[model samples]
Every structure is written in C-alpha cells, then in structure tokens.
Target: NNPKKTGPTLNETFLGLLYPTENYKVYGYLTNTKVKFILVTTDLDVRDADVRNFFRRFHSAYVDAVSNPFHVPGKKITSRTFAERVSTIVKSFGLSTAV
Candidate 1:
C-alpha cells in the first residue's frame, strides 16, 4: 500500500499566509508547471518610490533571509523570523521602511 500524501500547493500556502485577513486583492493564475505570478491591489495608494523599494527589499529578503530548502513546502513561517528577514532586507537596501 502507498502512503497518502497530503498538503496544499506552494501557491495556496503562499496566499493563505500572505492574505490571512483577506485584505489583499490578488489576480493571477498559476499552474503546477508554470511560474507563479501574484498581482496585488490594495485600497491604500502606493507611490512609485514605495513600490520600487518594496521589490528591492523583497528580493533581498528572499536571498539573505529565508532558508533555501524550506522555501519549498510544509515549512512553518513565524512572525519573528519574518520580521528579522524584513529588517535584514531594509538594512541591506539602506531603507528606513518598517517591515
């Protein structure tokens, strides 16, 4: 007999954790074999500078922060870990943005 495998896709897990409050508007579709894309729209207006900074910081966080192996699946995300990662990104980018 084969053991049952259970879990959500990475996209689902990402969105579930990213939009727990349902405050974000995401419009995009991703298949298991294709690259995932997420488009976010919020009520609060985002300035060009803020958007640029966010991307820079996000890239930094993705690189210098999250463990590469854990980025795959079934990994628990913690607030403190997230905060630290964001902080690292901000510092690396020389931004004063609070994460």
Candidate 2:
C-alpha cells in the first residue's frame, strides 16, 4: 500500500524529489555541511514556500547554537536555551500539536 516501497526511498534520491506520504508530509533541506533538516507536517495543504522558510529559520538557529564557543559540534544539543529557542520557533509557526 505504501508507494515508497515501489520506488526509491528519500534517502536514496535527491531531497528535491521527496514528496508527501499518506499520513504526513515531509520537507527537507540539506546543508553544505551535510546536515539535513527535515520537517514533518500533517497539513497536506502546506506550501513549499512555507517549508523553505521554516528551514531557513531553523538553519539560522542551528548555526547560532553551533557557533557558540562553549558548544561542541557534532554532539547532541543539550543546551536548555537552545531547546527553548527551537520550541519557540516551531510554536511561532503555529505548528504545535495538541493532545
């Protein structure tokens, strides 16, 4: 039933070719440093431009975090401030999920 099984997976192809699946839509941005930023949204009507904007903002925040002299690169981000900043950014986009 999954169309992905009939063809190449996202990891096997270019990021630009990836599309939405049944239950969720995936958008990806691959950085020159090989860092991949992915966003999964349940709203199928979401436009590509919105996704691009989200990635742009996220990449900026990520860079700020990694650029800190005290922050180590390639390690799990454990900074509470960074986590809060990311959460705030996501919420600012009105993408918060309610249980």
Candidate 3:
C-alpha cells in the first residue's frame, strides 16, 4: 500500500473509531445524556418508524462493525462481515418505527 495514497497517519483514537470500514446508509434518532432526542437522516426519504429502525441499525454498526479486531490500525476499512452487521442493524432499527 502506498503511504501517501493511504493518507496521513492518524491518532490511535481516530483509528480505533474507524474499524471494519464499511460504508453505510443510516437514519435514526440520537438521545444525548440530557435525554434530548435529535433526529438523524440519510439520503433516503424515510418515515418515523424507519428512523427508529435506522437508529438501532446505526447503534449496532457502531458497536460491532466499528469495533472489530480484524480491522487495521490505520487503513481503509472494507469488510463484508461489517457490511452485513450494518445491514441487519438498519433493518431492525428502520426509521419507519420511530416514535
């Protein structure tokens, strides 16, 4: 792999947050520590229920795919397993179920 083409070296925190590098399309709601719910969206048009579904999906993806061990320390992520995990999450947390 070309060092320059791979982009500059990033810190460990940044690298850790970038595991299982699969691209995803997500939609959901974010609840902060203050208990405020913030709506999130994607390029796709979705219903309230769909948003909930997406929220769950994103949560799973963030937990599983973005936390895989096989993923490299500082390289582009491209894992089919990661994509599958995200897909499952998306379906389960679809925005259509958002309240």
In terms of lDDT, the best-performing candidate is 2
lDDT of 3 by residue, 1-99 (tens): 675575324321111111222343432234332222233334343454455445554555655653688777456557787678766754555333335
lDDT for each residue of candidate 2 in 13-60, tens digit (9 for 90 to 100): 125426678887877788767898878888777766566667777887
Candidate 2 wrongly placed segments (more than 4 Å): 1-17, 94-99
Evaluation by TM-score, superior candidate among 2 and 3: 2
Worst 10 residues of 2 by lDDT: 8-17
Better of 1 and 2 by TM-score: 2
Q: What global local distance difference test value does model 3 have?
A: 0.45
The per-model lDDT (C-alpha) reads 0.46, 0.71, 0.45
* Lowest lDDT block of 10, candidate 1: 12-21
TM-score of each: 0.33, 0.72, 0.37
Candidate 1 local lDDT, 1-99, one digit each (tens): 335755544444122223323464443434333434354655334343444455545544444434555555435445466678767654554334477
Q: Which residue pairs collide, candidate 2?
A: none
Clashes of 3: 19
> In what order do the candidates fall by TM-score, top score first?
2, 3, 1
Candidate no. 1 TM-score: 0.33
